[model samples]
Target: MLNLNGQTHRRLAEAMQQAMLIPEGDELVFVIGRGNESSNLEALETWVKESLDVLEDDLALAVLPLLLNRLGQTINHWSPV
Candidate 1:
């Protein structure tokens, strides 16, 4: 399981956001991330490439808790009983 705490998730997701703001075929040459946020993003990207399926919407997860909440709502609608 990807066990990221709320704060870490938000921070890393912000890193993901900043990276997204860069143009395609270009690299993120500058980033204003805390040390742990930088490390977390590096690790998360590596893990995603190595192990998981990363979606485009995952790049927009500035608030992971909200994503979780939305996912819960989705699940509640989809699951039967």
Candidate 2:
């Protein structure tokens, strides 16, 4: 399983919401394959790469960070702190 911080979750939620605003109404689906750790992570990476493959230059701005740990290790690069 994977874990994500509240802020990271919110940011992804917001990004998805905004992405939905695209004029053509193109829907985005996140496919995460369930399996062993490496297998799942690999699938996720592939999905991300595929999703990014279609993003327009200007629209392909930020790829939010994943919070795999709950300790202080997880840092949001955009945060002032």
Candidate 3:
């Protein structure tokens, strides 16, 4: 299982705020997937873009890759296996 502590959560929350995914001053409670299987990065990218398309924030959409990269880094850092 993933073991992200409070600091990691806060860091991701702050990053999401900066990316405008979550509004400033609003609280974000996100849950990472609990499965142990690896996923396809290309599919994940497509999914993220499609999911965020409704928001119509071009700048935020542009930053999605960076945000995803940050998330990958955080997960790699905290993954137990």
User: Highest lDDT, which number?
Assistant: 1
| Residue 52 of model 2, lDDT score | 47
13 Cα displacement, candidate 1 (Å): 0.8
Residue 74 error, candidate 2, Å: 29
Report the lDDT of model 2 for residue 78. 46
Candidate 2: misplaced stretches above 4 Å? 1-38, 58-81
- Put the candidates in TM-score order, highest first: 3, 2, 1
lDDT of 1 by residue, 1-81 (tens): 445455665565457657766333213222333223235445444444334234534545656888899999999999998
lDDT of 3 by residue, 1-81 (tens): 234454554455455445755443212212222233133222233334434445456657787999999999999999998
* Candidate 3 weakest lDDT stretch, 10 residues: 25-34
State which candidate has the highest TM-score. 3
Where model 1 places Cα greater than 4 Å from the true spot, the runs are: 22-81
lDDT against the true structure, per candidate, is: 0.50, 0.41, 0.47
| lDDT for each residue of candidate 2 in 36-71, tens digit (9 for 90 to 100) | 324333444444444444553434333232324423
Give each prediction's root-mean-square deviation over alpha carbons.
Answer: 11.2, 12.9, 16.1
- The total of clashing pairs for model 1 equals 0
Error of 1 at 10 (Å): 0.3
